[model samples]
Target: MPSLDPEEGDAIRQALGLDRAARPYRNHYPAPGDDPVAGRLVERGLMERGAATPAGLVLFQVTEAGARQVGARLPEAEAGR
Candidate 1:
């Protein structure tokens, strides 16, 4: 796969619960607000949209490929796998 652009990389990181000082959360999926980069990632088959929340937020999850990309950037200990 081609390397991601910086914005794309950041989006994937955020979705994987690795951004923001690596503070893990129960809900790892993130709902980005009208981000073109996130849309591009969906188009590229790296990220996928999940069911909407009661508040109408569309959550985005990383695909296996997306996780692999982020995993490559993470240290083994930090990668948690």
Candidate 2:
């Protein structure tokens, strides 16, 4: 099982929850710089950052493995997709 530091784990959890309207993550969580945890997640294919929008927001998406790591029971809308 892959492990993460508390902060990294928190980020992953929030991403998987997929509640941006209520939570508004970008303004709150600063982007990682040379982040080892983020790198590890990428290396393991657990998460991916999409191209930045014109507004400079980089969309983050969690892979199935990442959701499983956080024990997220994805709803039908999000399941197996």
Candidate 3:
């Protein structure tokens, strides 16, 4: 399997279909398969990992770069929501 990389952040962002302004939703969640993508975003400085609660809930938030990336690729997958 291919690993998620900075080069692919845009693809992942497009897959997320997140709105720029309303992004970084407090309760925003990523699918199981998006872990690798999230890692890639982190590596690219496009996303950051938020503190996990004691309940084991993992938190992640997108950065400005992530938002721009998603916007750039919006036409690709028709904005993956």
Candidate 4:
């Protein structure tokens, strides 16, 4: 988690929608070039670039491991395994 401290786990979690997805969820990053966290998440295999959305933008869905990290579970359809 270089450049991202342990205290910032919340930020990463929020970015992954683990915190707000209690009501709903979607796959994405905040913006382009916001790669630091994205890179880290990718490195950990906690997130991945999935198919393009209707607008052709890449979707970043959280992996099973990522959902576990936030004490949530990815639906069977969304689970990587």
Tens digit per residue, CA lDDT, model 4, 6-54: 6335534664565666621544454333456665676777777555556
What's model 3's overall lDDT?
0.50
lDDT of each: 0.67, 0.56, 0.50, 0.56
Best by TM-score: 1
Give per-residue CA lDDT, model 2, range 1-73, as digits (tens).
6576676667676765434433222312224534565656667777665545565555555666766676654
Give the alpha carbon lDDT tens digit for every residue of 5-53 in model 1: 9998888877656776564332235564466887888888887777677
> Relative to the unseen true structure, what is the C-alpha lDDT of residue 56 in candidate 2, on a scale of 0 to 100?
58
Candidate 3 lDDT, 1-81, residue by residue in tens? 234455465444543444353333332334343477667666777666766756665555555555565543223332333
TM-score attained by model 3: 0.47
**Runs with alpha carbons beyond 4 Å of true place in candidate 3:** 1-27, 30-34, 72-81
Which of 3 and 4 is the better model by lDDT?
A: 4
Error of 1 at 34 (Å): 4.3
